[model samples]
Target: MAKTNLKTATAKQRIFRKAINLLNQIFFTWNNGNEEELVSFLQTIRDKSPNVQFQKLIASSVPFLNAFVQNQNSNLFSRIYRHPFIQGYSLPYEVGNTKLVHSDWLRSVLIRAVCYCSSVEDFNLERIYLELTCLTNGYSLRFVETHVQHFFNFFHLHPMRYSRDQIMYNKFRHNWFNYIKIQHELSDQLQQFDDKGQLIHLNYLYEYGAR
Candidate 1:
């Protein structure tokens, strides 16, 4: 009976270890993986057949992307010191009090939008908020519009591909991190090719990262 209990405990530990290891591999992109994950996001957006409508593709992915963002926000929110005694930098309340508010406006919005979310959401809520708001965060109405408008202009101007003018380096900076996170989420979404174009089933290399 004791041996059976020990074996059960060992099996549970193995599953927990795999979950932690997988999460670490997915989140740690700095040195663990190559630049392929980064470029793969761009490839997903840009690499398409002629029949694909750009707007349709973008529209379809919005919910999945938004879900991914909310999941991350929930994770971040859970990590913070919510106690009234703590006044640290990592507090979500800081975002609003620093901006001028009764409570954490950003946190409130995040809670309202994402508290019930069960899965990962979008990557960049800040960029999304840019379109929804005309105030705060060192942004003017015009400035906020520019950040989001480029995505539309990218497709509006060029039906086939993204133009340099449409998505300038400084214009869509939020997209870089967004795509990186999207690449991670994409990996979990399928059993086929990964964001880096690598076959996941074929390349179950538990050898590269720290296990």
Candidate 2:
């Protein structure tokens, strides 16, 4: 990467980066084990910012916050994956289901909100960028899962919809699994697909399996 104006010419970026510099510290101390720290950060942002959508999300997640859990794309290092693909969000619910996968607006909100909770400026950029990139292309980096369940539950979604690997056979997949039937038309065709190719093919099956 070339040296850019952000490092030298932009005063706002410099100050903005300084304001978030606290994220580099990891002295996260808690008293009484009640998650008052996370709660406080959420409250601060919700109370200070005038954005209605941001306020709404914070309000929903703070009270009912759950212990972070890993989803399919997550490894031991990265506990959190990005929100579920927008293509499948509509299958079960109809509210707030925007095409947020590429929305800088939403990601920016999430970065600040999560960093507030974390109280650190240092973060795993590769994993965040992985989220911004479509997963089928594959990424070696991952992020510790955040309170995604808070967001999902805020929307009243069943955990199964987003927990892709939790379904261990017996048809624990999408809600439409029962409807998949092979017609005689394509049964006789001999198709060839390699291992990675199989996943690449799932893009065509977005409705049934979104990876």
Pull out the clashing pairs in model 2.
Answer: 23-120, 23-121, 24-121, 78-143, 79-143, 79-144, 79-145, 80-144, 80-145
Name the regions of candidate 1 deviating beyond 4 angstroms.
1-24, 27-128, 132-134, 157-211
- Candidate 2: C-alpha RMSD after superposition: 20.2
The residue ranges of model 2 lying beyond 4 angstroms of the native Cα positions read 1-101, 109-122, 125-211
How much RMSD separates candidate 1 from the native structure? 21.5
RMSD to the hidden true structure, all candidates: 21.5, 20.2
Alpha carbon deviation, residue 180, candidate 1 (Å): 7.7
Highest TM-score: which candidate? 1
Query: How well is each residue in 1-211 modelled by candidate 1, as lDDT tens digits?
Result: 2223323433423221101233222111121234574344324434442222222222111222222221242232111112346442232344423433412343344333322222222213332543344344343565434433444454243221123332342233344336546766876876455565765354332221110
The sequence of per-residue lDDT tens digits that candidate 2 reaches over residues 71-148 is 223221112233444342121222452233323333344433332222112123422443444333332123113233
Error of 1 at 130 (Å): 3.7
lDDT of 1 at 27: 19
